[model samples]
Every structure is written in structure tokens, then in C-alpha cells.
Target: MKEEFQNYIDYHKNKGGTGKLFKFELVEYKPGFLKLKGFFNSETLNPVGTVQGGQINSMLDDVTSLLLIYESKGTIYPNSTNLHSIHHRPLFEGEVIVTAEIIKKGKTIATIRGEAFSKDGKLAATLIHTALIMKSE
Candidate 1:
């Protein structure tokens, strides 16, 4: 199962739109929790030379979704219904660590919390994600 999950993430990281661009690495993964690390390059920078809010949000969203998938062992698929992010600080160069934990897992719905931290261990943003869990056909 671990190998499968790793392969899944690798495939997306090499092929998916955001994954390909952000180059996110699946640093750690376990049931109900996961961590992804990446860097915000020049392309992700805003006009002021800081990482854009939307890019951070996208990273959180992707990490949360991947966490759910890993927890489910690929038996269920998730569709995000709601996402709320709060920015705590600006991020420029260096590594970004995204950690996600499942808050509640139900038959039909799930809630997850994700936090993004800079290389220096400062919190950059936090996100709450609500997703609909559906069985794979």
C-alpha cells in the first residue's frame, strides 16, 4: 500500500498541472496525516516578490487532498467542497512544508486541516478543507 501511494504521488508530481509546476515532494505519509515539501520559485512570486496567496492556497488544497487519498488507500476519491485559508506571513525563497491532518472522516464527508510553514519553521498559512468522499466505481 505504501509503495502504491508513493507511486501515485510521484505520477501526479510529474504529470499533474499544479504538481508539475510546484514540484511538491511527498515527504511523509501515514494514515490520516501527510506532509509535503516544496519551494516557491520565481514563478510563484507576486508583484512584491513574495509568494502569492493563491499559490499557497493551492499547495494546501493539494496536500489535503493527497492526505485523504493516502488515508483511504485509494478506495475513495475526494472532491473538495469548501476551503478557507488564513495567511500569517509572507513567503519568499526557500523550502515550504505543508502538513495535513484529517479532523473528521465520515462515510460521505471529511474535514481536514492543513498548515504551511517556511524553512525556518514559521507558520505561513493555515487552511481548513471540507471534502465529499465518494467510493470509486
Candidate 2:
């Protein structure tokens, strides 16, 4: 299952969309947990030279969904219901680590916590995402 998930991400990385655009690399993957590493250049920076909030939110959303997919073993996928993020600091021109962990998984709903850390190990942003787990027919 883990291999399948990795392959899924790998396929998407080359295909297109946010995965390809952001160049997210899967650093770790396990049941109920996933971590991704990505780097952004000046193009991703805001006018003030800090990473844009939308970029951080996208990373959190992607990682959280991946973790849910892993936890469900591909039988279920998440549809984000709510997302709340708190920005702790600004990030500029360095590697970013995005991590997601499933806090609770129920029959049709799940709660996931995501965090984005700067290269220097400071918490850049934190997110709590709630999603509906839709079972594949």
C-alpha cells in the first residue's frame, strides 16, 4: 500500500498541477503519517520577500490529504471540510518541511494536523484540517 501511494505521488509529480509545480518530494510515508520536503525560489516569494500564505496552505492541504489516503490504504480519500492555519513566522529562501498526521479517523470523517517548518527548525505555520473521508465505490 505504501508503495502504491508512493507511485501515485510519483506519477502525479511528473504529470502536472500543484505537485509538479511545487516539486514536492516524499520524504517519509507510513500509516497515519506523511512528510514532504519542498523548496521554493524567489518566484514564490511575496513582495516582502516572504513565502506566500497560499503556498503554505496548499502544502498543508496536500500533505494532509496524502496522510489520509495512506491511512485508508487507498480505499478512501479526503475532501477538505475545514482548514484553519496560524502563521508563526515568515519564511524566505530555504527548504520547507511539511508534515501531516492523522489525529482521528472515523467512519466518514477525519481530522488531520499539519505543520510547516523552516530550514532552521522554527515553526512557520500550523494547520488543523477536517475532511470527509469518502469511500470508493
Candidate 3:
């Protein structure tokens, strides 16, 4: 990324009050993207002995909101307007990685796209999210 864009991301990341989530330290933030890497433990598996859909959805939604908030510069997002997820295959207990990117950042709303990959580097799920800012400058 260009220096200007980097600065922009940093500026918003700082003044935007996005610090609390840093405690998780599970996700990595790029210029306009976020990546979360982790392996689902056995406890995360559902009765079917695979990662639960709700668990994956929760993580993806959180990352999407976090990224959109950063793109908003400093606005606080109240909630996501629409969230869509597609599970292509089962995610057995193993290492999983997720990458999400902002597709559009409007004045009051932002959209993001992400995908989860298993240890084999195959797509496990695809996510689309839209967030609506609660407060504005």
C-alpha cells in the first residue's frame, strides 16, 4: 500500500477507537483487509463432529464489522444490515484461516467479503456482510 493509504488506515485505526479488539490478537489488519488464523479446537465441533456453522459465522461477522469500522475512519457501527454465508464443505477439527476484504465503503454503510480456508488451503465458506454506522461525524 502507498504511504498515504497506510497512514489513513493507521489514523483511523487509532482515532477510530478500534483498540479493544486488539486484545484478541487473533486477527491481522492490512490496508483494507483483515485475516484471522486459528485452528478450531475439539470443543468447537458440533454433534456432527464438524465445526459449527454458527461458530464460523460469528467469527466472520466480527471480522467484517471490525474491518468496516476501520474503513469508516472513526464511526461506530451499530449493527450489520445483511449478513450472508455459504458453507461449501465441512470444516473438521483442524487448522483454519480466514481472510476478509472491504468491497465498498459508503458514507453510511460498508460492505465486506471473506472466505475461510482449512489447513488444506481449500475454501470452506464464503461470507458477505454489510454494516450500518450508528454515529457519524
Candidate 4:
């Protein structure tokens, strides 16, 4: 885990927010790419008995945004413009590993791709996320 992101996670870990709910932990990282592990439990399940699509999307959005923020050294703040997601299989309550990488980054926009895998290493969902870049002062 990188120092900056580790600090961010530590700072938010006990804040009673969604980070705590999802239990996101950095697994691996490099420039322009990273992998995260998340725990999904009964709280994340929909009535159909699988993790809800919205929860998965939230994970995708958070991971992608974190990557962009990190790659920019916190200079490129981004507001999500769109998130295109595909559900390959239903994810149940358990550990999920998500990987995100910068697809393309430009002055005014960025594109990121992310994939979520179940504990068994099966691809469960994927996302293509776009955001409008905002430079920090």
C-alpha cells in the first residue's frame, strides 16, 4: 500500500462511512494501476440473494476515482461523468478483489476501467468509468 492512500484509508476506516461498510483494503498497486479487496456481506445483498448492482458500482467508482487521484498525485480531482458496467455473474457475500487502471488520462477528462472478481477468482463485474477532470490549486 502507498503511504498517501494508506493514510487515506486509515483516516476513513473508523469514520462510520461507506468505507467501513465495504471494508476496502489495498492489495496491490503501481503507477496507474491498483488492486483492492472488499468484503461484501449480507448487508450488501439484494432481495435476490446476491450482492446488489448498486453496491458493486459504488466499489467500481471508488476504486477508479482513487486511481485517478493517486496517478495525479492528488492534483487531478474528478467528478464522475458516467459509469458503464456489466454484470457477468452474481456476486455473493464474501471477499471480492477489484482491479482498476487508467485507460486514458487527458487534461480535461479521464477514462478508467475496473473489474471485480469473486473469491474463487471468477470475474463477476466490470466497469468503464469516465470523469471530468478538475485540477486542484
The lDDT for every candidate, in the order shown, is 0.85, 0.82, 0.69, 0.86
- Comparison by lDDT, 2 against 3, better one: 2
- C-alpha TM-score for every candidate: 0.90, 0.87, 0.71, 0.90
Per-residue lDDT for 1-137 in model 3, tens only?
24533454455446643322221234467777877665566767899899999777766776676566555564576378888999999888766787789898777777889788878888999899887767755
Q: Which segments of model 2 are wrong by more than 4 Å?
A: 1-5, 14-16
Give the Å shift of residue 105 in candidate 3: 0.9
Model 2, residue pairs in steric clash: none
Model 4: lDDT of residue 42: 94
What's the TM for model 3? 0.71
Off by over 4 Å in 3: 1-28, 71-74
- The whole-model C-alpha lDDT of candidate 1 against the native structure comes to 0.85
lDDT ranking from best to worst? 4, 1, 2, 3
In model 2, where is the ten-residue run with the lowest total lDDT? 8-17
Tens-digit per-residue lDDT, 31-118, candidate 4: 8898989888899999989999999998888888878877777777779999999999999998899999999988898999999999
